[model samples]
Target: MEKNDKFPTRKDMTYWIIILILFMVGSFTVYYGSNKDMVSHIGFGGTIVSILLAVIAIIYSFYQSSTYESTTYKLDTSAQKIEEATKQLSDVSEIKTVLESFKGEVKEINESIIDLKGISNNIGNGVNSMKESFENTKTTFFESFNPISPKHVEVDEIDFSTNYFIKMLDNGGNFPLFTLALANQAHINKISKVNLRQYNKIYMKFLMGGKQADLGKDIHEAFRNIQFGMLSAYKSSRFVDIDFVEDDFIQINDINENLSQAIVHKVESLNDEQDGDKPLYDFLLTMKNKLSWDEE
Candidate 1:
């Protein structure tokens, strides 16, 4: 029932000791009876018996001491092992705590990173919204000035589509006039006039809303400005001039081809004839001279 009663105790050693002494006595009786003559030598027998007892006692004492030492060594070794095991357990506990702390920190960092990513996404969305609004504003601006063109636009870079639009605008709302102006040099002097007339005609038709509703007085002002600008440009010194025999003009049906060559020749001749003291050069020289005088 009780733990101590269940198992034997050190009190059981008394019974073992009594049994060992009884066994020793029995063994001595048998040995002495078997050696009666040995026992008859009185002094020698006593001496021999005493020596044998003393040797047995010494051997037993040595055996007991060795056994006690071995037992003590086993107990000490077990205690040391237990102490080391306890220290190892404590170290394992500390390591586990540190690992748990690291895990919590990592979790928090992961959460923070997720929040940052969400904030980035929100910022991206805001930027996209702003971009959309700006695009809508641009479209609205273009639509507002649909019929009439603007004078100038400022941009960081120029692209082909924008250049084309600028060319169209410069040509007084006549897209065809821009095309005609870039034609071969022959036509630039001769047929360019006819092409320019054609460009005006096209522009007029387009202004009348291209066979749809008549734009009427709405585009009248713009048309007037375009006609004035075009006429002014046509009469200006910028337009090419040709002087050829009347017969030659009648002979060539292809005005552009011949006039292109003539224009190239005229350009080369003008370059060659150019003097440093020409009025245009003199005007530029006058500006430089004024600048120098001012500096002085």
Candidate 2:
């Protein structure tokens, strides 16, 4: 749009032209007749010209006013359109901002998904590694002490380890194995010093899985023969009932079996390639599973 001052009004020009025509009409009047009855008039051409001049001036004024009003209405309409266009632009900008924010949120979500996938892959790899390790170590684990693989007895009649072991099983005065079991650690260490390693390997293999929870007063009567050395000291010991039920020994036996199995597995794994512990490993371990002393 051009400046507001540039619009044409034509009011001043119309007024001046009307005034000029009126002056010319006044100056052209003709007078005739006696003084008392005299009248003033303009000739026909002058009268016609004057009326036509006045009509033209009025028509020009009406046309100018109409044109000016039309221009003002058009300018007002244009201004309204410009204001609407500006508002639309602002709305579009706001929409663009909202879309940009949504896009950013979507990007963040995708990144989070990517991170989760990476974590999932790492977890998968770790699980696979653990599975492979377990597979590699599976054979070293033991089953029941009944022996899955039969091993040869290493000791013949002259084997020193065997003779020494038989001596440990012997308790003084015919109560043999029972007395040796409760001997102090020092006596046991001294007696087995010559072939201690072989004896220990033998003992551990047999008793590996046969450990029992201390039932304290619970199993006293069943194995009270174990306290025979000190039984004479307690005057009431002889009078105590020695009776036992089958169930009382069941739990102790089961625990021993589980421990023995675990020990076998560990030993087998350690000596898998060496084969040093193979000879009496199974025989002693299975023999120790005989929990009932009276059954023999």
Candidate 3:
């Protein structure tokens, strides 16, 4: 058994014992007084006094005993209830403290989650902005120069560096100008065969295709006009073509030496120019005109 249940309170037991002792003492006193023979001369008065005293003693003893027992029992029960209530109150206090701490932690975590969501949204928007910039730059470059190979096919990725150089020149990105110049030194090479007749012919055909909104003339006359334009455009230049059955180091060197210098000079001039602040949609519209379809 628990220690609390085993030990009864001493006050309750002592109160009952005192009431019992009082009853015994009162009973003995009344009996002895009533039986005394010497009180015969005062006969009736003595008997009446004795009987009254005895009755009084009995009533007082019974009342005291009942009161002590009832009071003690009630006090003991009340004290036990009070102790239980105190313990329950303590438990409730501890639970409330823990709950408050947990609530604070939860609030902090919720704030962090909100912050992370905001950061994620910002990053997503940044990536989209970069993608748009790249696309716009790409469209601008393709519009200015359409690169077709000698066979009239698009150049492969192996020539991407050369293509990048040409596009940057058209759009005024000046950084690569010096490098292109160095690559074009003629003393470094000679005896090279220069060949670009087919590409020139195609460019001429495209320019005088009679698709101009305002220009109106005979179709064959347009072709004649294009021939004259080409002569004037390249009047100071001369070109000769020679095919090599095998790899020729001298020819390759000559080709690079002749073409790289002039292109680099022209590219550097364009690079010094500034980029226009035109809206992207407007730029897109202009670039799209070079293609066959509409801007949509």
TM-score to native of every candidate shown: 0.32, 0.31, 0.30
Model 3: per-residue lDDT, tens digit, 1-296?
A: 66655444787689888999999889866876676664554677888989999999999999999999999999999999999999999989988998999899899999999987876575455435433533553344334333442322244534534444354444522212221222232223342332222222322232323121221233223323332332222222221122232321112233232235444445344434364322322322232232212112
lDDT of 1 by residue, 1-296 (tens): 65676435577878888899999989877878678675677668789899999999999999999999999999999999999999999999999999999999999999999987876676555445534533453344344234454533333333424343333333222222222222332243333123223233333333332322222342333433433433333324233232222311211123233324433332233233442223322332333343344334
Worst 10 residues of 1 by lDDT: 244-253
Candidate 3, residue 156: lDDT? 56
Q: Which candidate tops TM-score?
A: 1
Off by over 4 Å in 3: 1-38, 41-48, 126-296
Q: By summed lDDT, which 10 consecutive residues of candidate 2 come out lowest? A: 247-256
RMSD to truth, every model: 22.0, 21.0, 23.0
Clashing pairs in 3: none
lDDT of 2 by residue, 106-132 (tens): 999999999878766764554455335
Clash tally, candidates in order: 4, 6, 0
TM-score-better candidate, 2 vs 3: 2
What is each predicted model's overall lDDT from 0 to 1? Answer: 0.46, 0.40, 0.43
Residue 175, candidate 1: how far off, in angstroms? 31
**How would you order the candidates by lDDT, starting with the best?**
1, 3, 2
